[model samples]
Target: MSDKRSFIYMALVLSLITIATRATNNMVTTTLAPLGKYVFGFDNLLAGIIDAVVFLSTFISTSYINPTLQSSSRKKAFISANLIIFVLLGIFYLSNAVIIWIITGIAGIAFGLILPNLISSASLVDDKRTAERLLSLYSTSLSISLIIGPSLESYVLSMFGYKSVFLAFLPLGALAFGLSWYVKFPEVKRETHGMSAIKNKGFISSVLSITTYNVPFAALTAFLTIYAIEKFGVPKDLAYFSYIPFFTISFLTRLSMTIRPFNSLRYPLLISILITLIGLTGMVLSPSFYSFLIFMAILGIR
Candidate 1:
């Protein structure tokens, strides 16, 4: 019982860290349009480049850093990654356009460093059911942060302005960084890798399937606030909260998955893709704010 309790505690901490890191990352996307235009005097092209560079950096970092994360001390590496993010975010607030790119790029790398360790730590639970539940809760925690983080960004932008908003969230980052040092991570196992895994058709298909679902999801997250404002003439606050339907449904869907694990992944994936297509079509043809939100909710069912 004591060991199980400790594992649960570790899972919770890992979930909290996931929330902090992802929320911080989302805050960038949420504010990207306004911040780029208002603060940096950038046009869409420049803003897109700045935003794209973060994910590009993540890709580069993941290819190299993920294996290292798998091999190293998860606790120490996780703490260090958070520290790097904390430091870079602070610098990001003080930076100009070129400098902001540099800061955000490095922050993006740190963001990439977070996930493998978090999921690996959760997987340390000995029982398969418990581990699966923790992973679901872990995903749900991310949705909660998505709901909260942009809302907080909207609030801060409304009350404090852009730079102040970044400064305001620093304390939360500090808190996550401080609390991370106390969590106990499981022992690392050496990872085996080969081209053989990639050669498997099932492996390739699974990756493509996830990417298919994720591309639209990623686009929605990155641009939803701007899309809402431009399409509906809504205030930033309203635009930010427009995502509530999508994330709320997503959280509930993931919660349901935890309670009832998928019996077969293929059929569900197909159904989800169909639903997502309907949602995308609805968004393109949406006539009102409510309709678009309804579409977003539909999309979140996946």
Candidate 2:
């Protein structure tokens, strides 16, 4: 294949897998509390632990495992990670509370394996403009998953059951696994040694900046529905729709950025942070559902 053809094929595969992986993750996030209570007999404390452990394992696995894998092995690594997550989802069907936590931890590790490699792979294109556009499309896939995954899982849960939800999406996992096998990863000229990224000032600042943005977003994803229900007496089904506005606006924002690449990231980044802070404050202080939804939309613009 010509380089351009190869790049297009690879980008499409990556985009599909990105959608699948993100949707799977969001499905788990959306249904986690119910899955814990109904399937695993989990109390609040234990369910929280399961959530924490997945991210803890994710941190460990990404920080340690990704640096060890060669760029050449990223394709194999991605395929292996998807296969692990696929098997883990199957395992979730048979698990009790304790076993579910273990499965979550393993799945987190698999996810850690998936993300870094996926980003690195997406960035492997020959031209900077193509790379940015490909990344933007990949990010848009994340917003698509955010919108689709929870809605689909919620519908599936209402119609079928918890176990059926996982079973229904197992095909997505299978699809990602199959597609992963055909995607080619670029070669790295030099291997990055352990923890070398920490030494770079730019890398450190970027990590800290992103971590700041994601920390609250993570909390929101995990608890927004529950908070809406408990705080404002919103119906369970109604609460689930909260993601629609947040992600829809977010998707549009990213799409705009893709079309007109930011020449000065400084002003936008500053404005995003300011808006996010205001939105978070509004979320805490707001007394009603409408107010909260407005704040969420504000944050989504970032």
CA error at residue 206 for candidate 1, angstroms: 2.3
RMSD, one per candidate, in order? 2.6, 2.6
Clashing pairs in 2: none
- For candidate 2, the lDDT comes to 0.76
Per-model TM values vs. the true structure: 0.87, 0.87
lDDT of 1 at 279: 94
Off by over 4 Å in 1: 69-75, 184-197
Candidate 2 TM-score, true structure as reference: 0.87
Error of 2 at 125 (Å): 3.0
> lDDT (0-100) at residue 83 of candidate 2?
97
Candidate 2 residue 279 C-alpha distance from true site, Å? 1.9
Error of 2 at 57 (Å): 1.4
Against the reference, the lDDT scores of all candidates come to 0.74, 0.76
